[model samples]
Target: EPEVTQTPSHQVTQMGQEVILRCVPISNHLYFYWYRQILGQKVEFLVSFYNNEISEKSEIFDDQFSVERPDGSNFTLKIRSTKLEDSAMYFCASSGAGNYGYTFGSGTRLTVV
Candidate 1:
């Protein structure tokens, strides 16, 4: 089966540097989303994009964050400036809009120092 794949399963970055977390969603899916889990916290939705524009975004998605489909197969999340609070497991998900559960990437563990 086709699954979402994320790179650099683990990432370590400086507090003020930029980081781009990458993902490749399932081929036939249309809705794309990014969620983050801060250590033991519940998963929080960051943004959802469709039709080449943002459909919905949570407050967590601030000026420092942006997302793009750089190619036919790759979706990327860029953080302009990393903060200590930014350390978390960022998961990429996609769904085909049915009763099926969203498929999540293994997740990229971001650590800011």
Candidate 2:
């Protein structure tokens, strides 16, 4: 079965640096989303993009963050300026149908020093 795949399972970065997390969402899906989970915190939705446009975004998606579908299978999240608070597990998810369960990638653990 097709599954979402993420690279660099764990990343360590310094504050005020830049990082790009990569993901390959399940093929044939239309909607893609990014979520972050802080240690001992609930998963928070960051953004959802579809048809090359942002469908919905949370307040957490600020100016420092951006996302792109650089190719047919790759979706990436870029943080232009990282902060200590950015340390978390970033999850990439996709769903064929809205209101259904999402298929999440194992996640990229980003740790900012």
Candidate 3:
């Protein structure tokens, strides 16, 4: 029953500030992903990391955004400059296999004011 864990469950930052969200997924999982849910919008995939590199990223992942696995167990997403629209609940997820379901972290709610 391994699960993904995220720190700083909540964060508040001023506009134009940089923000980093950290996460540690199930050690045994092979795929790691970052998703965001705007106040009342559907979950959107931001990026996916595999084999220590970005396997895929959505249009939202522009030059302002980046993802990294500094260590084998920790995955992080960094937003170079925050904006009001960037505020959302960010979730980290991991899956052992494509066919298997994902285990998501409780999520880190980012608030930009």
TM-score of each: 0.96, 0.96, 0.97
lDDT of 2 by residue, 1-113 (tens): 88999998999999999999999999988999999999999999999999987899999999999999988999999999999999999999999876877899999999999
What lDDT tens digits, residue by residue, belong to model 1 across residues 1-113? 88999987999999999999999999889899999999989999999988667899999999999999978888999999999999999999998877788999999999999
Global lDDT scores for all candidate models: 0.94, 0.95, 0.94
Q: Which digits, one per residue and each the tens of the lDDT, describe model 3 over residues 7-106?
A: 8899999999999999999998989999999988999999998899999999999999999899889999999999999999999999887698899999
Model 3 TM-score (2 dp): 0.97
**Any runs in candidate 2 off by more than 4 Å, and if so which?**
none
**For model 2, what is the alpha-carbon lDDT of residue 14?**
92
- Model 2, CA-based lDDT: 0.95
Model 2 residue 66 CA deviation (Å) reads: 0.2
Query: lDDT at 84 for candidate 3?
Result: 97
Task: Give the lDDT of residue 23 in candidate 1.
Answer: 94
Off by over 4 Å in 1: none
Worst 10 contiguous positions by lDDT, candidate 1 = 48-57
Q: Over 4 Å off in model 3, which ranges? A: none
